[model samples]
Target: MIERFYLKEFLTFKEADLEFHPGLVVFTGPSGSGKSILMRSILASVGLDSVEAQICESSVTWMIDEERYGLQNESLNTFRHVKKEKTRYFINNQSTSKSSMESISSTYLRHLSLKDYSDFDPSAILKIIDERISARSPQYAGILENHRVKFAEFKILSDQLRSIEEKEKHLSELKEFALYEIGKIDAIKPTVGEDEELNLIKKQLSKKEKIETVIAQAQGIFSFESHVSSALGMLEVDSAFFDDAMNELHSIIESSLERMEELEEVSVESVLDRIEQISELKRRYGSVEEALEYRKQKALELESYETMEHSKSDLIKQISAIKAILETSAKELSLKRHAILGETLEKLNGYLGMLYLREATLNLEPCELNASGEDKAVLGLAGTKLDKLSSGEFNRLRLALLALGVESMNGGGGVLMLDEIDANLSGEESMSVAKVLRHLSSRYQIFVISHQPQLTSMGQQHFLIYKDDESRVRELDDAERIDEIARIISGDSVSEEARGFARDLFERARGL
Candidate 1:
């Protein structure tokens, strides 16, 4: 709801600041009194319309879509349009583009008489139709809810089944690839510690000849071992120490000679080949152990692949069962809606007839099963699309729809702006329109311009726009409202009888 609006430097209006409330807010004055200008400025303040006003701003009780637009929610957000070098829009003091501001405001504000077809959209129609169905059939909501749940489960399982089928088209190739990877690793037949031992043998083989020559030359030291002991015995000095040293030298020579004989049996070519194979495994899988682990994993996957058909069969059976039940429930829900659509259409046409318009047809065509079931509701206004209708006819149709929704709307729906909704309407027709608007005002905050007394009397908040030196507006007292309505009824010179009639209508509207 617009809490207040301020306008400055617009044509024929120097400055105006007006406080507003919910319910049917009406503006009334003689022709060319800038009533439309005031309305456009109000719309510009919210980015619903363009205006050249230097400053147009409105404070509203609308919560900004903080997740999308990144603006904080306030008790009241101020929407402003300023024209300095160029037009700029601001919401809650945050700079925003005109399109962005309009998108945010459109969620809470609707210009009923304009070319916006949001109310006639298929999703909106289906929602209202379902609401009407819910009113008549107590079990319809349960059926619809069941259909939605099953349909969701059905879609999910269907997607999974489809993916499995697609993979099955290449299942043979996949299995072969897994087998080939396992075979490639098994061919190496590598062991973890085998490579390290082979590397030691390769190092020894690389120095085999040189190490053999050194060991043969060192054998001479062992040959002189007995001579050294003899010399120590003759000198009678540490003959036992000499014996122990000779024994240690003899053990070292024997061990070195034995290791050299072992290396002579090691094939260097075979050691090199084994080392290359282990290096390849290391390069591919980081280690021989990792390669073995990967082979184990692939074998497990192949085993699972061999058993997938059983799982696929199980899923198919489950999906078939759910699909059958979901289809039945969706069909039943559609039947319930079709059964109640007449009552919904009758209420809509009744409202339309009162507004002096023709009947509207609601087409419930079949579509794919969805969360909304298997129905798509489209409202046709005498074969003319809503966006193609004239302003007056279009607005009347909108009123009928809004009236139909009053029963289902839980609370305040949004703000509605209409321009001269009662224009050129007969007294009876205008009164009917006013009554419908009054009914909707419980759910909507309506702003309307009126040249007729019937709607003028219906305003919960009435303001008189009159130009003296400049276009000015002020809230009217009861007596002043009567005068204004009487002026609307009797033209430039208000008659006594007109004043009496206006007072009665004003009082009657209050009673309604």
Candidate 2:
């Protein structure tokens, strides 16, 4: 619940601080006295509206999950928004992102003015019906869950079957391509590292003459080895060490000459052709190893194409089986929904009857399987689409749904901000709406703007928005409330008769 709201430089409100209480809080004034501006500023403070204001702040006292908002345990929290050249949002004085502020504020605040469409959503309608069923019949709830799961599986299989059928039209062409690619790779039989081996051989063959010259020079050194041994044998200082050194040098020279001889047999053209073979495969498939992997994949694809007729038949069978299951489950779920539709509509009419509105109609019909279900629900008011209803009628119908659905809620209800919900309503109808709202206030914290004296009398906390040179807002004292309601009853001038009626209305509301 919002405990306080403050606005600065926001339209007609230069600076205003309004304290609020739970239950129905109403703001009443003449038409041009900034009632809507105050509501917009409060919405902006909670990240629900974009308003040009220097500052908009709200102090809320509700049991919130501190961890979810990344805060320590606290009973009261302040949300502040300031708009300069760019708007900045803050929670507990710590700057945060706009989305984060929206996410947290949405849990506690709901602004349902003229344009909210959530009440008319088909999926939302189905969810409300399911919540009712779940509360009364847990077994039916499990059945609905099962049906939803099976329908999801059916959608997946149906999509896969459609894709495979599209591919099946070109099966023969796909088979031929896969086989051609596999055969092309197999023809080369390319091996990893074969390119490097061939390059090494090609390098040796390219420098064959230089290698031969080096081997000849090394052979000359071996000739000097025998002369060195003879001199060392005569000196007798270390003839064994000198002979060992000369033998090792001669061994290395002989190995070089042998290698040079081997190069004579190597054909540079053959080595170049082998390297080109592997390089061509690399150009097509990134690397030799990748080419081999591609060949393996295409081989499997070719095998699948060979037996595609049987696979296609199996897929058709699977789709038919899933479709049959989906249809049966969808019908059962539809029946259960329709079973509750009459009760829901009857209860809705009770609320609408009090509000002096026409009854709403529920239409459940078949649709192709979707993520939501195979049933499409359409809610109509007085034989007309919900979107075509008048704003007053639409808002009252939404309130009716809220009345029926609040019991199914899992957590504390959110704050409801209604902009002149009693506009265009008759005196009795306005009182009925006030009565329903006051009842709903047990679950939701309601803030409403009202032009009707009956609705204003129902407020637990009332504020009068008035304009002198500039617009301002102040909590109405008991005597002030009577004057305000009397003004609302009899226009700009308050008459003695209107005051008497206003007093009686306040007295009656207080008794209720």
lDDT of 2 by residue, 54-91 (tens): 99999887554667767553567888898888999887
Residue 467 local lDDT, model 2: 93
lDDT tens digits, residue span 1-512, model 1: 99999999999999999999889999998788899999999989999899999999999998888999888878999999999999999988999999988998988988866666777888788888887767666577788887888888989988988988987899999899999999989899888787788888888899989988888888778777778778878888978776787779788878888988887788889889989989998899998899999999999989877888987999899999997897788788778778878988898899999888878899899988788777899899886767778878878887888889887775688899998888888899899999999989999999999999999999999999999989999999999999999988998798999999999999998898
The lDDT, on a scale of 0 to 1, for candidate 1 is 0.88
For every candidate, C-alpha RMSD to the true structure in Å: 7.9, 4.2
Candidate 1: stretches off by over 4 Å: 135-143, 159-315, 378-389
Q: Estimate TM-scores for all models.
A: 0.69, 0.81
Please report, in order, the local distance difference test score of every candidate based on alpha carbons.
Answer: 0.88, 0.84
